[model samples]
Each structure stands twice: as structure tokens, then as C-alpha cells.
Target: MSKDYLSVMPEDFSDFGLSQPILKAIDQSGYTEPTPIQTQMIPSVMEGRDVIGQAQTGTGKTAAFALPLLNGLRQKKKASPQILVLAPTRELALQVADSFKKYGTYINNLKVLAIYGGEEYSGQLRQLSKGVNIVVGTPGRVMDHIRRGSLKLDTIQSFILDEADEMLKMGFLEDVEWILEQAPQQKQIALFSATMPSSIRRIAATHLHDPVEITIRSKTATASTINQKFLITNGMNAKKEALGRILEVSETDGVLTFVRTKMQTVELAEFLTELGYQAAPLNGDIPQNQRLRTVEQLKSGKIDILVATDVAARGLDVERVSHVINFDIPFDTESYIHRIGRTGRAGRTGEAILLLAPREKSMLKSIERASRRKIEMMHMPSVNEVNKKRIEAYKSRITKTLTEDCSFFDDLIRDYCSETEASVEQVAAALAKLVQGNSPMLLEEKKYERREKRERKQPVGGRNNRRSSGRSDEGMERYRIAVGESHGVKPGNIVGAIANEVDMDSEYIGRISIYDEYSTVDLPAGMPRQLMKVLHNARINGRMMKLSREGEKSSGSERFGNRKNGGKPRRSNPKTSRKPRTASAV
Candidate 1:
């Protein structure tokens, strides 16, 4: 095949020979053109042949397989599943299931059920008992149903392993193989992975019968439709503030913010909500139904932003998503591609903003090489810019109110003005005040109260000065550590260990005061649970240094002193032993 063949995008879905019902469904879906993967793989899948499709996450692989499979399915309820699709995560499973249902909307008697962990199984078992033409699930949950005799694959006509490489990365390859082995030998198997690693290729060779290979290689690394830009982070805690500012100034219809961890997803979402953005969290730990509801909210513009982990946002296809902000930079190139893929989908132009710390700047170069495109350096919207935008929005709202026919409100306004003997402008101003509520129309710039922490002066003294002047200031959180001066631990020990272990800059770490049996260190608040766990188990001076937030008695260090103290005990005892402190907060 010519190189151009791999990049061929069809003008329409009609050439794929889809049934009228499925074609109508596609037209209703607002998709006028077939993506490269769909254009190449649809016909092969319809021919009842095993196919191996290699394409990136947003290349329309779901429809590539789903359309053909739906078209070929006989419109009748069956006792056994006709098609089984194994996705690595619950989000992806639900996504694939939705796709199947959408394409088969016009086809009668087509029941698609999504089964995954973290959800009650009774409903799924009931659905399976009634008969589902298609079953989309994670491997472990699918295996559970299989073992329980609820899902029988003996009559399955086809098996699909979506994101096979992701399954391998998630350590689901074994479960996937076991599920594949259990399927009837007569069934055709189709495997789609972004990258065909040796392990995935081995599985294909073992299970598929002369599989037709289809690869959709994009002509460009990054999608041309997406405007990719990067913003240098102020510090570890500034992502939320920067994101808020960006949203304030940018024309975002809907946003998908990618964080590194599940806990961070919730943290960022809550933070955004506190900042007056309609945001919600999407993660693996959230119940499947709630997650779906959150996605629906984002789709309907009820939620303007969705803070999500990389895994949770997989296969999330929301058309209104106009911006993707990498609140946490992805660790790899492929993840970057998949994350930005959430936007700029189906040929729509979208914006992708990446927040990068100074240390993470190298990853930008790596990603640039991998994507074969330059990520333009972007200056975050200034506080002044945000204020201007907010004021403009307020003015626009007032202007819109003028254009609106307010006969209904006019009576109330006239009555209120007459009763109060007020002027028209006064009534209008009062109404605007009520409409604005507590929301601020302008933002103030607080230099020290930003994402980047200001450099603090190093505490002067030896370990014995631990009780001296190390005190927690406002905006800083104190954490207790089990390893202290009694264990020959110095201030340098705590700073070095935390900075190295947590991948944090020393400048961000605040005051460190070592006590006899424990120590207190001031740090940023709202740390993710994963990082806290890692820090809790951190070892120093050959001792397990248990770290926990100051107020929380998780570490049983409250007896030592108030956690808010920099290092000074609120009430000092001469009998309390201490060592010489060196290298206080850097």
C-alpha cells in the first residue's frame, strides 16, 4: 500500500457500505467524514475477518469497529453475547458501550451492557440474563461474570481487545489472555492498540487467524486542529490558580483538565468550584454512574470543567470540549496525545494548554521531538487580563439584559422604583447588583499569595536552636515527621529527603524544626494522597520517617507540640533533648 493510503480520510461514511439505519445514525451524530482508521478498518471488520488496527486514541477507533459490528449484527435478542469488547478501564468500557448503543440506535433489539468494577454487579447480571447482544467490560470484571456463569462466551461471534497496549501496561494482559482463551474458537478476534508492542503482537499471533493489519498513521504528530501551548508553572501549588486565570481570559466552551492522580482530580475540581467555575471531578474511584453523570454534565455545559486523571478521561468523547489544560504534565508522549485528543475531535479546532514547572521543561523537548511539533511557550493570563475579561463579561451581561424583552420583570422593577421613589438607573443598578451576587467582577493581584512561593530566609542556628524561631506562617501548612533530632536527623536530612523523594523543589519546602522524637516541617497544603503516602513511608537516618499533616493525628505526633509551630515548641521543656540543627528550610 502507498504511504498515502495510511493517511487516507474518506469524505463520507457511505463508501464503507454501512446500512441505512447505521448511516442515518452517523449523520445524526454530526459526523460527515470517516477518520483514517474508520475508513480503512470498517470494511474489513464487516467482512467477518480478524483485524489488527493500530491507531492513536482519538482516531475514531471506537466507530471503526463499532459501526461495522453493529451493521453486521442481526437485529434480534440473543441468549448469548454476540460481541465482547474488553477495555482496560471502566471509563473506556462505558465509552465503548455508549458508542455501540449510539450507532445501533435505529437497529431494533440491540442491547449493549457495560460491566466494570466499582459498580454493583446485580444489575449487570440481570441484564446479561435477559440477553445482551454486546458486552463491554474490564477484564477482571468480565472474568468474574464468566466464572459466575452469568456471561457465557460460547456463542460470541467476535471478541475485541481495545487499547491492548494499555491493557498490558495496566497488568491486565493476563486477564485479557485468559478471556481470549475462553472465547469460542470459531469467533473472530480484533485487536486495536495505539502501539503494537512485542507482547501485544505475540497475543495477536497466538489468537488471531491471519488478521488483516490496518494502521492509521497521522500525517502530523500532533493534530493540526489543536492549538498547543505551554505555560511555565509558578510552583507546585499554582496549577489551579493558573488554570483559573486561563479560564477567566480564554474563550473556553468546555474544559477537560488532566491531573496526575485521582485525589488531585478531586482537589483541583473542588478548588476550581471554590473559584466560581462549574467544575467536577472524574476519576477511577468515583462510582461508574456518577462518573457518567459528570461526563453528561460536561456535555450539556452544566459543568464547564471536568478535572480528570488520564485513565479516567480515556474514550471520553464530549463535542463541546473546546479546551484541554494539562494541569499536570503527562509523563509520556502517548499520554499527551491522548489527553489533548479529548478536544479538537471530529475536525473541530481546540486549544491545548500544558502547565510545566522549570524542572519539567525537559519533558517539553521530549514531547516536541515525539510529536514533531513545537509547543509554543505561552504567558499565562495576567491578573489584569483576568480582571479585564471579568469586567467585560459583566458588561456583556448588562448589555444582553438591555436587548432582552423584560416585560415580565418591568412590572416588578416599576413597582419597586415607584414604592422607593427611585430613578430608572437606580433600579437597573440594584437589579445588576442582585444578579452579580457575591461574584467579583474584578480580581486583585497578590504578589506573595500566588502559586509560586516566595523565597524564605534560612533559619540561623544549630540543631539545638530547633526551639528557637521556626514557626508556621499563614498560607503554609505544617507536617509532622517521626524521625527527629533524637535519631540524629538534621534539617538538611528532612529537606533533602522530601525534595528528592517527592520530586519537589527545595524552595517550596517551608520551615523545618526538629524536636526530640519528632519534627515539624511547613509545606504546601492540598497535597495529593499518593504523594502523602509516599512521604509517610519515607525513610531517613535508617528510620522510617512517618509524615502526616500537623493537625491530623495520623502519625501520633500531636503529643510533641502544636503542628503549626515552625520548629519551636509552644511550651518548651528543658528536659527535652535536642541536637544541633543545620540547614534549616532552604
Candidate 2:
């Protein structure tokens, strides 16, 4: 077929030829027009042609393959497995399976099962025994099933490799090849990959029978729909604080926050809920029923935010989700696209906010290049903005309550004024103050003080000078290390390690005093107990840290004089051998 053949949308599936129930479900799901990938690949697969689809993430790839696979399912046959879909990660596998489940829900005798690592194997085994029509899984787990003789491909009709490049990147090409070899020779092979590296092309040429090549060029296709922006922060905690501020300022109807791990899904959901957001967690650990319910609630406006791992939120269609927050940067560009695609859906304008730490800024550039669109840098909402939003929200609630129920409270207010022997104006003022207690508007003094403190605490220059005076202050812990001026230990390494491991910013780390025998670094006061333990167990330059106060007996040499000297440690050149001086000698 000509390359132009794939350029135009297919007319054959214009009607979808799906059963009435399936068509109704699709209509209810708000799918009006087919995405380019879906339009090109669905008809080819329906024709039983070995197809090669090249498209990036967020291009409706799941439906591109799922619609045809479901359309090909036989109604009267025994529920023996007929279609196999191999995906790279557990998240993608579950996502594809969910797509199949939704589209195939109306098809009788079609059972789709998703198998992947980190889940119960026996349950999958039992499901396999019961007979499944379609199986979507990661390569290694799929190979395990095949090895266990649980997944029989004897009657397989179609095999799809979704995100083939990702599977290769994850070192699953061997398992993919092995599984392909095990499948029936007559089976139709459809390979879908974001980028067709030579290796994937070789597989397509060898396995596919003169496959129709479809390439969907990446461009500013979805960029206009998505308002992409990034927030820069010192570190993770600062990112969280910025996220809270952004949420406060945003007028989002619903939000989806993408985190890296399932544990983070629960943790962030709980944190958001505690911050007075109606939030819930969506991850692999949540039961499928609950996952579906969560999505429905998000759609119905019961929950304002859904914290999810990529896997759990796949195939989720929540049209009201106006905002998508990347709580953690995705490992790959494709994942980033998919995460943001959760918003700006169905032709509705949506916003995607990314929180990037200093180190993660590089990944942002990579995503920009891959997506072929620039993500604008977004300033974090300042304290003033956050306070304004809070006050506005408070005012709106007050107006609504007063408009709806002023009669009931009028008697109570009069009684309070009479009992206190106070004028109505005075009582009303007191009531207003009580209602707006401790609001951000009232905390401007604290906010200003904190901002002033941060500005005053900027670090001074020079390695030696910084080490001497950096951390010699109240609320600093002195940590002793074996490597000092002799071992080439620098303040940056110490700061970098602590910042990376304990989620502390470099600014919070204090002075470093180097000596011939060892070095002492000052850390922030009230460091989490867990972080302190981590520091105790941490090794820098293969030397364990023995952390203690500055005046502790273990601090061998007072390279920097005690607090009395104002953290001005004696300077010594590493090239010259000088006797290490102690505090007592000074």
C-alpha cells in the first residue's frame, strides 16, 4: 500500500460494525471521531493483515489495537485464548487490558485477562485455566505463563506487540522473540511501536506478512489542546509545597496527579485528602471494581482529585479532569505524554503542570524534544496568590451559605449579642474573626518573616570559608566524616548526598570544616528522625558518617573554632603538611 494509503482515515470502520451494545457503550464513552492511529490500524487488523503501526503515546493507540481485536473475537467458540498482546511495563499491560475490557464488554464469550509481575501468580493461573479469549501482559510474565504451559497459543488468531521499542529498551526482546516463535505460524502479527528502530523493523519484516506500514508523525497535534507548564523547585518537599499552592490557585474541576510508585499513589492521595481535597488513590493494589468506581466518581464530581500510578489510571475516561499534575517525572517521554493526555481530552482545553527539581530539569528538555512541543515554565503561585485564592473561596462559601440559610442563624446571632451585652456590629465582627481564624490572610506576618529569613540565609562563597562558617549556628548538627581535606571531600558532595537521600535542599545544609583526619558538616536542625538514621548509616567516599553535635567528644580537631569563634575555622592548604589543631590548643 502507498504511504498515502495510511494518511486518510479509514471509511470501513466508520460505522464501527460493533454490536448495538458496544456501540452504545462507545457513544456513552464520548468517542465521536477515531484518532489517526485507530483509524489506520483498526481496519487493517480487522482484515486479518499483519500490520505495523508507528505512533507516539497519547495518540489513542490502545483503541487502535483494541477495537479490531475485540471485533475479531468469535461469539460461539469456547473461551480459549485467541489474541495475545505483549506490552513493555506492567502499567502498559494493564492499560491495554482495560481498554479491551471496556470495548469488549458487550461481546459475549470474550474474556480479557491482564497478567503482570507484582501481582498474584496463582490468580492468573486460575484465570488461565478457566480459559481467556485475550491476554495482555508484560513479556517476562507472558513467557512465564507459556513456560508453565498455562497460556496455549495453539488457536491464536492475532498477536500484537504494543510499545515494542519500550519492551526492547526494558530488555524484553528475547522474551518477545521467544513468545513470537511459540505462536502459530498463521497468526496475524501487529507490531505497534512509538519509534521503529532497525531492530523492531527487522522483527516486523521477519514475522509480519507484508505488513501495512502506518506512521503517524509526531508534531503539535495535541499540544494546542494541552496547556503544558513546569514548576521549578529546590527539591521534592518544595515541589509538594508548590503543588499545594498551584492547586489552591487553579480553577480545576478535577485533577489527576501522576506519581511514580503505587506507594506514592496512596501517600499523595492521603496527603491531598488531609489538605481538604476530595482525593482518592488509583493504583494496581486497588481492586478493579474500586478502580472503576473511583473513575466514575471523578467523572461525577464526587472526588476532586485522583492520585494515580500510570498503570491504575489507564483507559480511564474522566472528561471533567481539567488539570494533570506530574507529581514525579516519568522515566520515559511516552509516559509523560500519556500522563498529560489524561487531561485535554474530548476537545476540552486542559492544563498539565510538571513539578521538576533541579536535577530533573534535563528530563524536561528531553520530553520537549520528543513531544515536539515546548513546555512553558510556570511560576509557582506566591504566598499572596495562595492567600487571595483561599479568601475568595472562603467568601464564596460564606455568600452561598448566607444566601441559602440566613434565617436559621439570625436568632443565634441575636442571642449571642444579647448574652454578651454587645452591639450587633461588635458581635458580627467577632463572629467574622472567629470564622476566619488562622486564615492565610491573617498569616501574612509569618509569611513575610519566613521570606526574610530565607533571603538572609543565602550561602557565602569559597570552599574553606563556607566550610568554616556555613553551619556553625543554632539548629545545626555537626556530622563527622573520615575523608576531609586529605581525601578530597568537598561540601558539594555532602550537600548533594543529603539533599538527594533525605529530600532536603542544599540551602538547609550548613558549614563544613575539613581537617587532616576527618571533616565535619553541619545539617539542619529538626531533621526527621528517619533522615538522621539515614545519615548515620550513609557513607560518603566509602567512609561511614559518625554524626554528632559540634562540641561532641568525637569531633577530633576543631578545624573551625567553637560557636564562640563564629564558625571561622582555621584555614590550611592541602599541599602543605601542617599539624592539625584542636579546639583546646587554639
lDDT tens digits by residue: candidate 2, 446-519: 86558646744543221234334344543245666555555666666667666676555454555666665566
**Candidate 1 clash pair list:** 462-581, 463-580, 463-581, 470-566, 471-566
lDDT of 2 at 403: 72
RMSD of each: 7.5, 9.6
In order of appearance, the predictions have TM-scores of 0.75, 0.71
Query: Across residues 156-244, which tens digit of lDDT does each residue of candidate 1 receive?
Result: 99899999978876778889889988989998788998888799989999999988888766623237889999998644455666787
Mark the 10 consecutive residues where model 2 has the least summed lDDT.
Answer: 577-586
* Best prediction by TM-score: 1
Prediction 1 global C-alpha lDDT = 0.80
Error of 2 at 461 (Å): 15
